[model samples]
Target chain A: MSYFVSPIAYIVLLVFTVLSGVFFFIYLEGFAQVQFDTRAQLFQQSFSLTEFVLQPYFGTISVLLLLIIPMLTMRLLSEEKKQHTSELLFTSPITVINIVLGKYLAALALFILMLLFSSIFVIVLYLKGNPDPGVILSGFMGLFLIGASFLAVGLFASSLSQNQIVSAVISFGLLLLFWIIGASSDAETSVVGYLSIINHLDNFIKGVVEVKDLVYYISFIFIGLFLTHIVLDSQRWR
Target chain B: MIKVQNLTKKYGNIVAIDNISFQVNKGEILGFLGPNGAGKTTTMRMITGYMPASEGRVEVSGFDIADDPIAAKNEIGYLPENPPLYDDMKVTDFLDFVAGIKGVQEGRAAKIEDSMNKCGISDVKGRLIGNLSKGYRQRIGIAQAILNDPSVLVLDEPTIGLDPKQIIEIRELIKQLGSERTIILSTHILPEVMMTCSKVVIINKGRIVLETTLGELNEKLDGDNEIHLKLEKYSSDIKAKLSALQSVQNVNDLGSGEFIIKSRQRNNIGDEIARVVIDNNWGLKEIRPKLNTLEDVFLNVISSELKQ
Candidate 1:
């Protein structure tokens, strides 16, 4: 299908996959070289410094997902609406919900396929060195949640207008607000901190997939997609 | 069948279609005629649910445009003033996309073939829309609109910008399509309306100024025939002499030793005017009668209004 075969999707996938793989390798090398003194007897008798270095890896990947989701979703409805292909879509019996869902799924499917291809990094890590499989799976779970949440926000941005650039900018702006609020807040401002998508991924990076984090991601996706649906519906009125 | 009652469309304070009403029966071609800024396209857009009316309603095959837009849109096929086309898509792929969206539930390939064949763009189906000629592109546009085989077909300026031959071919195609389906076409080409539409509605300044059957519109302006006379001896007495004749309604000197005379009835004015010229010992260089035209009626109405 042209949807999967398009070079834009391939380029985004390659860039993100390589960058994350490089981060994973750097984290492993940093752990292997670091010399700890009394910290070795502080808590765990046998815990890999490699895993601790990779802790920030999942968080960094979450940030990468947020940064790149707009590239995948900016073209969904905006391109069709801009090119006037929307008339072909609108006059058909297909409802606005289906069009929105079809495009969203198409983008997500491409993203997931790319993620599958990058699982080679995980396999290589297991072959070359010993790492906890549970932590790896939990990191993947966090990646999926972060990707879906960002994609929903990007889709909502796409629904606002017929310009792909505008959609990408708005999606990035919205996600950056959430990421900054999640990182720089204390318990007193925990409300804003809890709203952070990266905050939800923090527990996952620590090999803990909390139900509350899952709910947060799902609710974020739901609200973003719900707003996209409303914006598309309002086009008929315009 | 379609009935638009008291249909008014306004963009804020500016009215686009003002209290317009018209009916299109089954299997008839209705021509919507108006000037550049007329409400013809606006009315069509409203009927197709591309836009909504500010007030009133349109019913297509008994389904209200606003109350039941999906059903009404399903029954009607619309080609807008500018064909909404995707340049990146191949002609066949574009038509397939249109068929998919138009909800052609069965025999989609066959229907697409039929539409392409009807529009005579089957040969260019493999080519991207941007690479096609203007005439072929227009055909693809029409092909997409008719892909679903809707009962009511609406076309706006379908033959616009086509060469003379292409225009005739498209006009003939529209006439053939009108035989089985109800058609509403808006065009500034008066002769195309005369040849294709069974009835016509003329609008001006966003208002329906006239609505009449084609035969009625033609007959209203029909004054039988006109005679052009060329005389070697030019004189003011010629007008008085032609006016006194039984069939002559009015005579105007063209200031070039020529005159145009309109007859009161649909009689052969060539022989009568020739006889009069010979009897008056006038050196008649030419005597020819012309039939009534839509242009004549249009100008007559506008000119009379200007005179008042």
Candidate 2:
């Protein structure tokens, strides 16, 4: 509720919703135009609703999340530090792990709320076209995993500093680092390529739920939360 | 109920608080008095386990803070210099959150109400904390601090930045709360200690300068009796005559028939001074013993330490 109360959260939500909606509509219109111009060719080719809509929708949502998740999480711990309210929590009976988990869960809850709103685009596609519900579910799952991973990293960034802008910048830099690492990897099948979060999400986008992809995202989330706990605990010593 | 043993805190090489130690018995209010940068806040933070000390131990209700932080923290309620408040949260909602986090599972509503009423913030329960005044916010801070009814309360400058009336009200509230739990309140204000605290520990330059009760402080100040006399008629010879007396060690004229006569020992020399005034016909209007204030003690201790 505290995060939702901030006007920045609403602004971020609105911008994300509008941008994704506009891009989804443009993609749908372009696809419709292509179908009209080459209806015979389109029918001959293997045209998939998942490829036409769900893929683009989930891909666009990931990019939007890269920008929006940091804003959602920057104030999680930074505001408490800035206002000197962290002292209350530090002195309370709660441990640093509890504080870190509590704030991370709150940010995750906000991310889930945003995901629910973005599902409107998927619902629209489901009604307008015969998209596979299974594919759509997998895509939604991938989007959620990526968003949660971003949120965890952003939460760790928030714990790093008392300045919200610094936290946001750090989170953005980290997410962008993970997003672009696979592109620079020499081999696509190499271990280095797996460092990129976007690489792992490819399987989920194609409606394939590989155990390796699940482990990648789950590890990312765990590492982010663990680092956050360490940072929060270190503050007590200083 | 609260015992701090040789609590020393250092930030890098800078000693924020030197080897300082004090104890607050159950139901006692210990005034943590100091000037700015005198390590009062650091000491309180160490006591509350908000931060760890470099080389000492703090025990609250027989639980060592460093070894058993959760158990010790559970026994304490702390209010930092600035109230730890969520400006976006309403008073009731904020207190409810605090109550929940503090693990007050049963009778939570009653506990919140009791704290709000005790801090005189029941009227602002429905208002946003951001919309409230500083005084009200401070009351809300106190309200949250007392929510769990901890055995010890640590307040860092509770009356700071408050108006006189608000300061008095908060002081009264602190006094009322101190009746049930041990409290350590830090403040740079002198008379606040004299008025509210039962005992005071004055710290200067990261060290404890004095730890004495208010009654003992008054008695100590009164022991060095100095008579202040104001007379209508001025006489140059009155000083010599007063100094010539057996009890008078020194007599200094403070201009316009006002004289300060220092006694050789702790004795009431008002009658002796009156006799001199009558004999010399100096028209004595006012004559009284000047009691040393907390300001005097504070300055004396601080300055003496600086000289050393």
Candidate 3:
């Protein structure tokens, strides 16, 4: 169903190439200041693609994703309701869950397309410099988890209201809360600190595959999607 | 077949439909007659499972609406107050999408084609629904409702917002559709009820105030049998003359030498009056009987209700 629109595919490819080239130019310009004395140290502390590409990659993606997911999901149910076409679909033999998931998967497929395009950034760093693939792969894994979680939350917010503006505000508000909680909390008992999507994302950027952190990101995605399903189910009652 | 029992719906503090019970037999076209906001649409919505009733049991094709909505819904095709169309989509695509969701299988193309032809929407099938005229839009809406070939069809104001020509065409189309499908058509148009429906269910104040068959409706109005007589001769004696006849009930000599005679039973009262006029050799200027019609009954019922 989603294959007919190539804007999603085109945007991912264009952004990935443009952003990676801009970052590459910045790295190349910074390299001029390094002297021969740094060559040995550079070999020892090689610019890990995992650190150079994935950390900055996810940072850029997390913020960009917050804006884009809501844009894509805003029209999901709202347009259906506004056009009065929900009457046809709701009264049909299909279940509400199938309708929700069908659109959800379509959006996820687009997000995956964007992820595939971003993989070029890893390729650019690997060819130009000595970068480890393991860390880079884990970083991409983290990006996938964070993007999925954001999309789930955006989908839930989109399901809440028929006005796209309202859905956007709710999604932005939830994303902002997730962002600030870990940053503001004290370290010792900061489950909020761990809940910080940014903090969970940091472990993957550093090339360490922490199983517990992986579990946390996966659980976050699952919970957001589960809550979205619950919201849709409850809306029928109200 | 459909049965609605003890149906009641309330919006916040206001009651929309209260304790309404009615049943529709197989292969019947039942007209729901009510003035605006008299709960006709609300009851139709409840029966179609578009909204939940506060208290009721609705059964469609042997399945309870609340207990098995899927089964009940499967039996019915409903066109709501609005058409519920996706205006952006082309007519064909919209119908195809509905057919897909409705789970009407591989024969959907044939069904869509037949419905489009039947509804007179075949010419505009390729155009976007947003671009179609209001008449065509209504036809497309009806087309979608019957796309599944459901056993029961519910149409809420199918002829609303149309020109006279469109109204007649749509009415004729509905009459044709009603032949194969049991239909519940709700409208305030009295003539529409009289012409299209086999039975009338008149609702007032959220209750079924009257239920009348077409044969009974004619009997209530008693057909046209009143005779009017205009005389040149003064006739205070004519009142007793008419009352004594077996065919006449009572007679009133209207001022200006005209008299109106109402009969107790319908018969050839015009002939009886003409024979009496000939026997007396009176100069009768004119004689005519008033034709009883459905409008009289409607007016009588409303005026009586107002007086009460």
Q: What are the iRMS values of all candidates?
A: 2.7, 1.3, 3.0
lDDT of 1 by residue, B201-306 (tens): 8887677777889889877755557777889987888878988889888887898679989888767777778888899998988776656679777666655645
Which candidate, 1 or 2, has the higher DockQ?
Answer: 2
* Superposed Cα deviation of residue B108, candidate 1 (Å): 2.3
Instruction: Give all candidates' CA lDDT scores.
Output: 0.80, 0.87, 0.77
Which of candidates 1 and 2 reaches a greater lDDT?
A: 2
Q: For each candidate, what TM-score against the reference?
A: 0.87, 0.95, 0.79
Docking tier of model 2: it is medium
Model 3, residue B201: what's the lDDT?
81
Question: DockQ for the candidate 3 complex?
Answer: 0.33
Pairs of colliding residues, candidate 1: A92-B101, B224-B266
- Per-residue lDDT of model 2, residues A1-238, tens digit only: 3666556677877888888888888878767766667665756876666787678878888999998888888888999988788988999998888888888787788778788888898898889788889888888899999999999999999999999999999999999999988897473787779889998888888889999989999999999999998988888888
Give, for candidate 3 chain B, the lowest lDDT window spanning 10 residues. Answer: B290-299
Candidate 3 clashing pairs, residues 3+ apart or interchain: none
Best by TM-score: 2
Off by over 4 Å in 2: A39-43, A185-187, B278-285
Give each model's clash number: 2, 0, 0
